[model samples]
Target chain A: MTVRVLLADDEHLIRGALAALLALEDDLVVVAEAATGPEALAMARAHRPDVAVLDLQMPGADGVTVATSIRDELPSCRTMIVTSHGRPGHLKRALAAGVRGFLPKTVSAQRLAELIRTVHAGNRYVDPELAAEAIAAGDSPLTAREAEVLECAADGAPVAEIARRTSLSPGTVRNYLSSAAAKLGAENRHTAVRLARSKGWV
Target chain B: MTVRVLLADDEHLIRGALAALLALEDDLVVVAEAATGPEALAMARAHRPDVAVLDLQMPGADGVTVATSIRDELPSCRTMIVTSHGRPGHLKRALAAGVRGFLPKTVSAQRLAELIRTVHAGNRYVDPELAAEAIAAGDSPLTAREAEVLECAADGAPVAEIARRTSLSPGTVRNYLSSAAAKLGAENRHTAVRLARSKGWV
Candidate 1:
């Protein structure tokens, strides 16, 4: 089956260039494209594509949130992160979110196309160096749920509001927040959120 | 097929009560339950359910974003937004994201079950009052793409950055920002983003 793809990146210049190149593939079609996290999400909804190629940093939600959301809502459409900055923490988070492919932007368009196909076929591709580097850097102790909960509390929303928004009760939300804080050795969730954001775990 | 459901809500007290009630239905199984938006997403991945019953407000991501992500990636699993605040803009956004149902939290479990079954059957169920209110409130001038892009710019990302993030050229990004500003009659994209968010248009 031809792979229908959504390409999400903030770099419009590169995005267009890549989209044009990817268009030449016989088995690939760029069905939708987005420049920001929110737009990427909207396009994904509008397209329900076979695969999504996301950038790590966008104006809004970032690649991890987009990947997580898609994983939750669109299991059939596989996702991958294409980032210029291949931080170990980021790679781990993407993998935890069930991202099938992770690569640096240096890869040629042809390589990206093949990886998209692989992802659509329910396989995974991780940059060897990136994976090794992540291993060398050790691991982010926070679980996916803990990172997600901390990300939610990023805006300093009150615990009750956070509880309401996450569907986790106030106490459970606190537990996750505290756990995240403890894992990061931060004094509180605010510090933990900042730390996590700095590390891009969230 | 028996309906597998994921229930996402912050009110653990209510969530537990509802889960217990839902457990009574022989044809329906509460396969997973989540208390926060991120947890909901995680649980959905852990258990690919037939339907996701989501609260409108969750900590990590709102119900609409969650619905959009699911619709984009998980075509097989249907989604519904259960909100206490039935604002028209939110309803419209949810519907646009391919939410199969939108209802108030005041609904009885029996009624909620029926709606879930309806969604599982690939049908839609919007609360009559909510639908009317949305219609009465008229339409949001911004298209889904526009809303999404503006939402991306909410944090005051520059046009170039927004362009990069949205995959639009700088010119196109500017146009969208200007257009959104004009539509909202705001002085600039920043104001427009603020206005759109205030109205829940983004």
Candidate 2:
């Protein structure tokens, strides 16, 4: 039986090309395509594709949000997250949202189709490297205090100012900055802040 | 004309499955498969496939290294990076290394094959969403000094310790923390570090 598939991504060129690519597969049928998260969710509910390939970041709702909706509304239809961003946090969140497969856009076409087939077949699929990194990193790295301090640091705020805002002593704020820097393996607060922002931890 | 392809990734299941998937395509042939970067480079040189799909992080020479070698040796073969990790830094580096296409592993099997065809046809392919985020975030957000300070913080080093290590005054370290907080729009140093680490900016 041909596996019904749905494609969701905001890029016109990518979406069209992906549709064309999927169409080439004899056992894979492109049932629908959506450009945004809401459209993706709506299309999935309407078309009921056996599997949905979703990009994480979308126009209205994000992929995670859509995945949650799909799980609630169409429990049988599996969701495979297809995204360009491979942030560990994003992967963790995707898993938590009940996505059966997590693949990054950098994957080869052959692997992608295989993953889709695997996920559609009801087997879990995760990038081994990402799974390892996610396991190693665990949850958020920053302590509550450190995360607060780092957020303040990202804005170029002074320790004294951060201390005043967060009701911590200036010395305490400095300590938090020091701790955060240590956690990120950064040499200074500025570098720590940049690293945190990129990871979407903050 | 049949498009010759080379596969490089460590996972046996994925590597083998991908080979099988691509082999089904009448116009595509898997000429070589390698589990490591060094092997991939050697295979690419040996087979000289029309396209080379490489994983970013491998046991020995990683995807970027293989891409560089492929670009230098096989100018006719278009290089496409296929990795599970979607770190912007990796993507930027892959492009810089002369890879014509960047595909995340999450793409459908059909799309992956299509990308190979598209890229081999002299077109470029990248996850559009990633492309946007990369454009938005640009390159390293922190200055060299800030990165140094942040790395120190990641180690849980105290401000005095960081200052001592970096030869900066305590006041300078504090200043850097504040600047990072401001840039990251974080309320505290901890939050700044978390944000920076998430973005891989540090």
Native interface contacts retained, candidate 1:
0.00
Q: Residue A107 deviation, candidate 1, in Å?
A: 49
Candidate 1, B1-202: lDDT as tens digits: 6899999876553465567667768889999988788888888878989999998987899888888877776788899998766778898889889998999765667788888899999899999998987887677799776877787776545667778888888888778778888998886665576567656676
The CAPRI category of model 1 is incorrect
lDDT of 2 by residue, A129-185 (tens): 777766776677799889988887666677788898899999999998998889888
**Clash totals for all models, in order?**
26, 95
What is the per-residue lDDT of model 2 for residues B1-202, given as tens digits with 9 covering 90 to 100? Answer: 9999998877553566677677778999999999888999889989999999887778899888899998899899899887654677677877899888997766766788899999999999998866776777678767888877877776456789889999999999989988877887777666677677666576
* DockQ of each candidate relative to the true complex: 0.01, 0.07
- The native-contact fraction of candidate 2 is 0.00
| Cand. 1 TM to true fold | 0.40
The parts of candidate 1 lying over 4 Å away from their true place are A1-202, B142-199
Off by over 4 Å in 2: A1-30, A34-36, A50-61, A72-202, B1-3, B7-28, B50-64, B71-202
The CA root-mean-square deviation of candidate 1, after full C-alpha superposition on the true structure, stands at 20.5
Instruction: Grade the docking of candidate 2.
Output: incorrect
